[model samples]
Target: MTNRTFDEMQPGDRAELRRLITADDLFVFAAASGNSNPMHLTDTDVDGNGTAERIAPGMFMASLISAVLGTQLPGPGTLYRRQTLDFHTRAHAGEEVIVRAEVVSKAEGMVRLRTEVTHADGRQILTGEAEVIAPVEKFDREDVEVPGLVVQRHRHFEALLERARPLPALPTAVVCPNEAKSLGGALLAARESVISPILIGEAEAIRRAADEIGADLGGIEVIDVAGDAAAAELACRLVHDHRAAAVMKGHLHTDDLLKPMLDKAHGLRVGRRFTHVFVMDVPGHPEPLFVTDAAINIAPDLATKMDICQNAIDLALSLGMEPRVGVLSAVETVNPAIQSSIDAALLSKMADRGQIKGGQVEGPLAMDNAVDMGAARTKGLKGSVAGRANILVVPGLDAGNMLAKQLAFISHAEGAGLVLGAKVPVILNSRSDSPMSRLASCAVAAIRHFAGAR
Candidate 1:
């Protein structure tokens, strides 16, 4: 790897560092970097009004600076002297931000410069000045091949879905088996794992649907339920009675399923808030990104958020991440007006003080500053998880849902959902989700089950 010092930087040079702020990116940054600000993106309007608005992390601005300073300005092998910055406002994805730098002075082996990354709206996100030392002459280079990155998932949907195979051997239960698509998804999941299928619903309808979908039902046990209400009850009973290790939802309303699953007596409570998280894989990002509460927990408070954070951290640890969390918000600084920013700071300090463990927490950061080290450097932010974040804790469900859908639909990202903070893994996916996403969700759920059971 080529290390960069700040010497090769020049005046009047400008470049754009390509960063696609997909939902996965936003989710990861929010957890790993701690910048769950309101301005990143909107998930849902509380009144069902319209949309959600979120601010990009100022640390993202700092990350852009590092990108320019190291990759563009100094052209590598440049020495970093010092840098300072201030954020004037917020920025978000779908908006373009440009980083510009000018060489102010050239002295004995030293160059002084000022730089800023701003939104197209002309608002300055971050402004800073720096001193760098670089070689006057350039190093010789030979045109040679560089190794490519090894990928675990990509455009191949089937391969990505089957990455983790031979799922669970325990019998699994499907709740509210009214919707054919939901039953189909569950059936597909069954084929991938050793988990025997126990269909809890209208026996006649379930069988007819299975025939239409061409799914086998020979070994599947079809439990007849009188109606949606009875079906919902039976699904939870299966889990509570130790008939199944996992529960899958079919066609009933989310409330219908949640009611029985969370009945306190028959509920699958793990002594913490139950939440939904979608593991995302964007094209540019190398690994899976987890976006949470997208389908559950509308507006989580700080304590619930702590549970959410722990849940995401637990999934990352399961997926082999040492676990770094970024609490997201509109700005990287604590603002009295915004509870999210204040909470982000408290959580960061909490992580430091051992109140929250299993990861490095930083925030009050925007989205960009969370993932891009270049943005971190330009803004002169030094923290544990500023540039390299492993988990993202979103402020609310609106942010989480919109972020996940945007990446899954608008941008090219894989959405693999799993419900964490439970005694066992839960694959609760949406009908709008792709089959591969459904399969990947099952994979994550099954792997968690297998690993936890051991």
Candidate 2:
């Protein structure tokens, strides 16, 4: 960057910058300015005209002129004396604007500049004039670095919901929805058109739960079952009778919910054993992260681990993501002393030898090199699944459960749990899951059902 000295400046000398205003920019500006007006912060119809507007604050537009004055024209060591601004129109997120500044006049150690901000389509948004103490010394330097900002929002799950909204709502048998949290979650998914839930539990308890949440259960099917195990068994019967496309665990222990589905005579199993996968929407991650066998398959053997990998890979494919499986261990290299590292090596070789299909599998990767590019590079790892793994296959239930919880509590990720390898996807949400998590679980199940049908 080079700056024009006070003596070098002249009338009509101009500088301009084009900036694309983004939603993140608006949020950052709101945080920096401490202005939380709904008109500028929210993307909603403030005036009730119909168009949702995330209007950029007027001062945000004015700051563009400041950026131009400080970096360009009389670029460095510039001090603001006085400024006047006139708002002509509104700027919005996702719009580009041009901020231009022109030297109007010069005085003793001071310069006057005309500034204006206009939309990319030529509509003026803001016009202003500024007087500044221009730099007397000719200043030149490289660009300065600034820290980056990460907006902690769950965009991946939101996108998954959007993708699922177009599909036909999956017919889900919600087992034992006898409490407010579970019943409310199913109803919320129903409202979002992600699921058509058949409430299978005690009729009085179901209605009581509905009343507790102020929900109307009209036009929804409710099956009155007396016991948790009986309700789960009835849900399995519904799947066999072609009444439900999926089963949702609601307000019951996971063992009771899944035990009926494992019956050899009337089970929902197609072939492989059921394995749990947590589809985590971590903030700032480019895609969904899959953590598998978290809720089931405690200390799985090599065969069960293979099933876990295949189940997660299939789910990833159903969600339209090319699966890159990273079988995680304590170290990146196979060691005779470490059983997990040995298992990871075997999993990688098995995938290479066509034992596991539809995904790229690489393993014996520690947590760092599995998901982080810089860490992988530093460790001299080069492969598709080494650094950019979307699916993390852990050694046992303990590691998988801990990893998923760490991402949820520490990293602030939203997780949608699903049990795969059955005839239908099982929505395995917990009592502590937020509404969005439950809804996302339904969306994922619906998406997977439709995708598999195709």
Candidate 3:
């Protein structure tokens, strides 16, 4: 006839038990809850993956506590009627996690209780009210924030790279011979952060290149393909077989590497048009400026252009850019002879009608008009994407490649290029591309990968 104590009648409180989450605990919870959001586990919640170190997924903690409430505490016979949860701050990992329920009132077969799950710092991470029909049942509660890094730091890309932590040691394959230097860059990237490398060229050549580059190839594994062609084929196979998560284009011809990748039967081709992107760092631009179709697709039609736009949008999202795209051309009007101008108009409208996702697009703007508002005004054009464009979709390979090179050579801009829309961010740098540029591309890909970018 006496009312039972909250703990006595229900599951033992984690608060009362006073337990701390270990590395194992974090890993288990992450796997079990599908809350692989790094911010909940890592130190920086800054990148697209860890944007704000968000308060852990409420569903994660609620489910964890509910397991105890249903299976162990109240055990076997409980009916969960209703409950409301309010989340405030973050209950980061490693700290002791607490769950407590205070019985408030019970009448007419209804039980009302105030519940709280607080961090060890005594700050309440989750607090709310719960109600049940006396024969209490298990209940779960779940938020607005996107899980990956979607916001950029108020600083520079170099600074952002400085802030990045080591990658998860995911397998990486480096194309042979000359690309061994790329493997060296990967090594530098790994020496500092994520992207574990598996060199797939001739062992002797890979080591020799690694040694000349002064990279730590001691622990590096050599797959020993006969030549660049074989190495590229092997690299693609590794990715297809799941041996590597990312494929890096090392000292091999882009055409040779892509031949195997695009093979319908035995490669990593996902049946989409293969496109290229160059991540450029300009002194005046706030974030890394990424341009696309620079290295592939001589003159993409509407279909291929769509893929290029989408891929750039994903990369921009990873870079925390709002993805304002400008289809670069000589003029804003869709002149009959100017196919680029027409394509730009179509792409922009496609974006407006929801054909494109996660960004805005406009086209046929002159280079000066696309980048400089004053230039746009002088040309008597007006629109958001007409000026201040972040992702430039050039009309053809000629225009796109030429425009990108001007930004690099003539203006001396800093840029890195990658091929996207693949399973992962593909690192494809030309020999003309400086070592620093190659490293920059790798850093951008790492940031994008950690951010869970496509």
Instruction: Give me the candidate number with maximum lDDT.
Output: 2
Model 3, C-alpha of 170: deviation from truth (Å): 4.5
RMSD of 1: 17.6
Ranking by TM-score: 2, 1, 3
Q: Which pairs of residues collide in candidate 2?
A: none
After TM-score superposition, what is the CA distance of residue 96 in candidate 1 from its true location, in Å?
Answer: 37
lDDT, candidates in the order shown: 0.70, 0.94, 0.71
Q: Compared with the true structure, what per-residue lDDT tens digits does model 2 show for residues 1-454?
A: 8889999999999999999998778888888999877787677788798988889999989888899999997898899998899999999898999999999999999999999999998899988899999999988878766788777778899899999999999999999999999999999999999999999989999999999999999999999989999999999999999999999999999999999899999988988989999999998899999999899999999999999999999999999999999999999999999998999999999999999999999989999999999999999999898889999999999999999999999899999999999999999999999999999999999999999999
Q: Which stretches of candidate 3 lie over 4 Å from their true place?
A: 1-155, 177-180
Q: Please say which candidate is ahead in TM-score: 2 or 3.
A: 2
| Backbone clash tally (model 1) | 59
The lDDT-based order of candidates, best leading, equals: 2, 3, 1
Candidates' TM-scores? Answer: 0.64, 0.91, 0.64
lDDT of 3 by residue, 16-53 (tens): 33456544455556776687777655556556553545
